[model samples]
Target: MTDRAFRNLDNLRASASTARVLNLLRVSHEHGRTDGWRAAPLFENSTLNRCLVIKHRLRRNEIDAFRVRRYVATKIILPIDGSDLRVGGRYIFVDQVGFDAMLEQALGIGPSHPDRKILALIDELPSLDPFLLREQLRRNGHAPDPCYFNVSEADLMRMSDFVASEITPLVDLSIGPDADLAAENPVARLTAKIMSNSAGEDMSALGQTLMLRPEEYEEGVFCWKGFLYYKWALQTITGDIGWVVDSVRRVKPRGRVDTEQHVAIDRAKEQVRRRILITCEATADMLRVYDDAFRGLTREGRPTAFRDFLRDAPILFARLGERLGAIQHIVSFWKYRMTGDRSAPGAEELLDLLADFETSLSGRERPDVLALAA
Candidate 1:
């Protein structure tokens, strides 16, 4: 469907009560002064921050109806970049309910759960890109309603397009010239409903097209979609990533640092750069496994290799999302925090940012890359 029709369908989905804490930019400056909570524009970087950042004053320990918004560089679905930097969801970080009626109208915030684990799952990763979120839900085995996703057709098309261009040539050859199954299909409709709910009965259209069983359709096809996204993500950042690497080495902090601080910052910058290259190279290598598997399906008409690859791919997402999220975080946050007329932060802040980036890229051993993507 067209954007207009997709929006019409999006409008019909369920909504939650008036959201109070979400509209961080629009809240009255005076309304929360009595309490320690403060609401202000997330950034003075132009007028639009695309996200709402609320900070609080006393009792900082997590408690009482608050949320944590995971910062992201690019939202996979909406493809936000350049200026738009919408942060993620919330938690018990708040102590007051300033105005509950006025905050729910934002473009993305929606229904929430009470479980802290669930909330962490929502905010932990840098981006809640639906394709990965879908995988997260299935593996964790938490079943929420489809309205939980709150996705529009245009948003769903991002995954559809990625799969078409990168994953499923069978989708094109089996159908018509159109490889894109994203256009107003029942599968897309249900997937849009709950990105995690890709196991819809409507899998027939795609499954039959591929001549696969329901089991294969559920596991193999969905994993294919996720891998294709990771491939696109690696390429998109390949050109821009160097700027972040160089900036880390060259960008000077506004304040001087003691030897410990200076040495730590230097260590962090080098480590971040080195690991970023290693992780990215490792990621490209893993993607080649998918590429080879897909080749068997599309070229050799052999589904076994593809199906086997899907079973093994989930181990990779935790690594992919963490590493890519950090990379995307540094690049996008650097653009938001460092570029333009925004003044540079002190050396301490730089160290903190680099440390965080380094931590995210840690833990995964280099994959046994066949390097077919090379």
Candidate 2:
């Protein structure tokens, strides 16, 4: 990613929807008003100051509603570094009615609230056609009704209703005391709907499209997923490296004559550490590219550009896996030298598998590697 792209992402992170609301509230509260708004600075650097700062006055009847929204925003909205950031199902943090009122307050009295233009853009979303609105939800794998897929008047109306009755509530769940509204909130219902729709069903092409080409506002959903996957892979590799390093230590005898064996074990451990670090750096570079690609391409709502990312991911993973597989082979060689243990966990089986695979690739028998596998 270029320096310009990093700047763009930094700008996006600064003006995230929840962050914008929080910043507005924070700036508003700075003026010696006791309206109960407070700023909770989330992250700060030389170039960025992301904050949560949206603790507003809680009405007697509004506590439950506020708690839920606060929880969802903290859990979903804040972690998403950039993008509009939406939460679904039980995670909907702010309802339209409460949000509109808050915005009115923020815009009305807060002279210093930053990024009014971005706030205006977020506000403009609601006025767009419900069809276009629903399409955004559907594109994010949020599962808007399939009936809204067409352009008929009836379908458009259905889309409108779905937007009003379904999407809006999920987008913001701060709707205060209404005797007519169910005690069972829209969050619970939306959560149930997502679970039911996803169960035992192959993802539709629409769903795949959504995953591949997430909307700018929905980039949070995919970025979080990628973050989790990246963390898990890193943790697994770390664990494997730790175990190998420790074992090498245990095998290194405390004598001067066995220096050759000790040196070999130490070298193996160091090699593993070096190789894994290089792979991790490569992975970080890939993640930067991934982040920039989604943030830049999806800004224009073009999903086709996303397919390249999908292609790049597997190629990257395959190279990492191949490197790790080679590391495993080296570990097994050192392990056998130390312990004289041929059955070194999966070492024997992995060698056999690789030997067969290489033979298939060569379309002929290679006796050297075949003998080693045996």
Candidate 3:
């Protein structure tokens, strides 16, 4: 059997098709053993290919049958590496969501269950110093280098034993019989929907809803789902409005302010506002910009652009009402405070605002319509 397997390995090397089969078998055998299966070749396609190759090569040999049998046994113990075992393709990190799902399956946890999260598994490593662990593994004849630390595909199979021991029981408890039906889970369904729709028209529609009005903010846009959506223009209020007015006084002094120049100024302010608002910053920073813009407005022989901006403010709010209603409400509340609007929105009013925004999105527009409207 050893001799036969060895001869088969050699024959596999000689023919690309047979080699592929043999290599595949070797990988399966290796993987099975790594996963704590019996450490022997399981008769799979690669193994059969290896055997066929050997049979073809040795058919003309005049060796006695007994000797051939002995040779086969020896060959099995020393089979050569086949092409199938090589790692030649690219590797990709599984999506974070998928990785979390796999972990739950292996560890018997739910997505929201904090006790069995990946962080818990990571924390379970022996608290021994890394230096000590490296030394111990090395003393046991394992090369404990960075290469060993790196988790390869082969390593993943090998580690499956550890995973099975620690994780399988937990998963069994968490999932029960229903675990077999991953397709029915709402989270899984949502994840699939999000992935598929990430580059679609919904993203653009969402973006358009977030845009700011020229009077209230600035003129900037963001691209989502392959389309550009206009965003609130806080940038103009903070950056361009002051500078443009000052520049106009210096450049054209008494001449009528250029409409093109005013537009450019508004555009600059819009860009700045979007950057500042969308950033993950504390509320105070946003308030500062709001306060400054308001203060600046108090001094104006208000530019026509500013008045036009106020006229279009409702449109911006309506669109923003559609994209991120919660955020828009926060902005609206703040805007009201800045403008000294006495009436405060109630909780039900906030919910209604959000509901109305969601309702508007029900009629999905064509990509072209969304792009043009945006």
Candidate 4:
């Protein structure tokens, strides 16, 4: 974490760009994590404001060369598969005709169908909240894929261990005895194989054993993985929220703190602390839906409930992931700033940070607040 981390936080305009890029990055990475992305340009003022301004920086197939362009304010639902996250959408390529031709040739994007925008903000953040990632899928459209989403190698590194610790019990609870699986349905053997890779790799055989249709199996497996990631993420973020609550006030800002500014700061601190906890609790409460459904499947032997839970996961996951990501961006950003060796942001920047965090929750909105003398 360096001053560059919070460089955008000082100016109001840049701060908005910062927030937008961060949110887009989280949503993109969460839904489509396999590809490498670099945020070359954060904002632009081209005529094509509505579409994603995509350009290759250097070599054609170099995974790192994504640049920015300006376009009309097009709705980038994000690519479910790293190129297009949602259902079929439209893009109006309103930019340089010559370069547009080159991009069209390069990425197969025509003037009417130019590609790329989700990667513009990937570098500004470290990790994303699971809840927000899924929310983007729901809101944007169905992120159609074999696994419903993709996973990068970096993220999958620890997944094998997570599966090792949890999947055996899960299999026992959901499926019956091993003898039954071995004798009648050998495809159920994929249960053991699942622990080897958590990316839902080649699960069609497992899906067949579960009696899930092709589409159902794909969506179900993705939903299942999403929940797994959510569970993993929830544990870590719970600790993060705890840290934020405990240290929001304790983490010193760089500049002076006069009495009036102190009072405002206190108010802002209380609001952020209280809301952060409340938001985390709400996300936890939503997790109970999946919990109850799992209980029904394992304890009561009602696979229907679990199936229903999987089917309905996108909607619920979207809402839950979104709220979690918002708070997370705040807390994580704050933590990044505090842990840096350089001087902290001054009082005004601190005030803005608290104000942003205070309003970053579901169904909540607040105008920016001006800082008093410090």
> What are the per-residue Cα lDDT tens digits for candidate 1 across 332-361?
666767788988878876876776677667
For 1-374, candidate 3 gives per-residue lDDT tens digits of 12333334443433422101223233343454353223332221233222221111111132233221211110112233444323222111112224346534543545565423322322222211222222333334443222212122432344334333322332333355357645655333322222231323422332233343432231111111001011122321334334433432232112344666555444543433343243313222322332333233333332332233333333332223222222222233334332455443333332233232223222211122122122
Model 4, range 103-198, lDDT digits (tens) per residue?
Answer: 455345554541233322222122233334334533544232222233433345555466445455555654544646546443344433442234
Model 2 segments beyond 4 Å from truth?
1-231, 236-251, 254-257, 295-305, 323-374
Total backbone clashes of model 3? 32
Q: Report, for every candidate in turn, its global Cα lDDT versus the true structure.
A: 0.50, 0.34, 0.29, 0.48
Name model 3 segments beyond 4 Å from true.
Answer: 1-25, 28-30, 33-53, 57-59, 66-77, 80-374
Q: Is candidate 1 or candidate 2 better by TM-score?
A: 1
| Cα TM-score of candidate 3 | 0.14
| Candidate 3 CA-lDDT value | 0.29
Best by lDDT: 1
Estimated TM-score per prediction? 0.59, 0.27, 0.14, 0.58
Give all candidate RMSDs, comma-separated. 12.7, 25.0, 31.4, 12.7
User: On a 0 to 1 TM-score scale, where does candidate 1 land against the true structure?
Assistant: 0.59
Regions more than 4 Å wrong, model 1: 1-114, 123-126, 146-163, 171-212, 368-374
Number of colliding residue pairs in each model: 10, 6, 32, 19
Q: Cα deviation of 103 in candidate 4 (Å)?
A: 12
